[model samples]
Target: MSHVTARVSEGERDRAVELVQQAYADGLLAPAELERRLERALTAVSAHELEPVVADLPDQVVHIASTGGRVTRTGDWHVPRRLRIDSEYGRVRLDLSRAHVPYSRIDIELRLAYGGGTIILPAGASANADGMRTEWGKVICKAPGRQSPGRLHVQVTGELPYGRLTIRRK
Candidate 1:
């Protein structure tokens, strides 16, 4: 989805600062990166847009995993494994393990929806198909130089459906 922009509130800004500070203290981000994200948060237009940018900060990080049975559901839900991270300049990984569907080709889908950012895959890592199947939905793992720090889009598709997506620091 496209990013939604608007004016940010005091509470939102405060939360942003708190998150950034925590990231810095944890040594997840460098001094410069912390300053950059702080500036963005201070002058953010809207909470919605700020959230993604802040979430993608250099120190802020994330890790998500999904397997068989119900993973993400509404109300009275229980996550066998769930982790949401935020750092200054870090890595976000998604480990997906899907069971095979016998003779039929299982369709494994991966989606990365954010306002704008870069999607870095594992080093020397290459997708089963092209770097990224644009028309098909999966995000193209653009070169680091071409990485957009805003509104990154990713989607992974698999037929065998037995693999995991992991995110970690170098």
Candidate 2:
């Protein structure tokens, strides 16, 4: 039987472009290849079309959403280039001490509504919470310095409304 191809969403296209750009930035792709992949990703209409654009990229984008309850990611999980977390009346935790971070940088987007969470990273990793915002909530970022060469750099972005976000190094 012939498999049906799923249509590509705008987010997927954008993610593909981001991956291509990241690969180019990381020196994994040549300028011409980056241009070609970006053009393909931008004009992709189906998942099949977009797959090849990011197939050679080493990083991925993961999205986790919770309506209510607790969600946690720990242990030796593969850390994607971009991670988006959404919680509504739920608690979320990400422990990245043992995570496999292939890239030197990662971006995390958080959307917490009436919920709180904590992020535990390795001591060698450095965190940037400049893009994060809070309203009627508290965000405690205790990221230490002295980043090693080629260490992971995490950029935390997004909003927390009436919820707490704590980033600590272990």
Best of the candidates, TM-score: 2
Cα displacement (angstroms), candidate 1, residue 160, comes to 48
What would the per-residue lDDT of candidate 1 be over residues 82-134, giving only the tens digit for each residue? 12322222223332222111211111233322211222333322323232223
TM-score of 2: 0.67
Q: Name the regions of candidate 1 deviating beyond 4 angstroms.
A: 1-4, 56-170
> Which residue window of length 10 is worst by lDDT in model 1?
99-108
**Each prediction's Cα lDDT score?**
0.40, 0.85
TM-score of 1: 0.31
True-vs-predicted CA distance for residue 35, candidate 1, Å: 0.4
TM-score of each: 0.31, 0.67
Query: Which window of 10 residues has the lowest lDDT sum in candidate 2?
Result: 144-153
- Model 1 gets an lDDT of 0.40
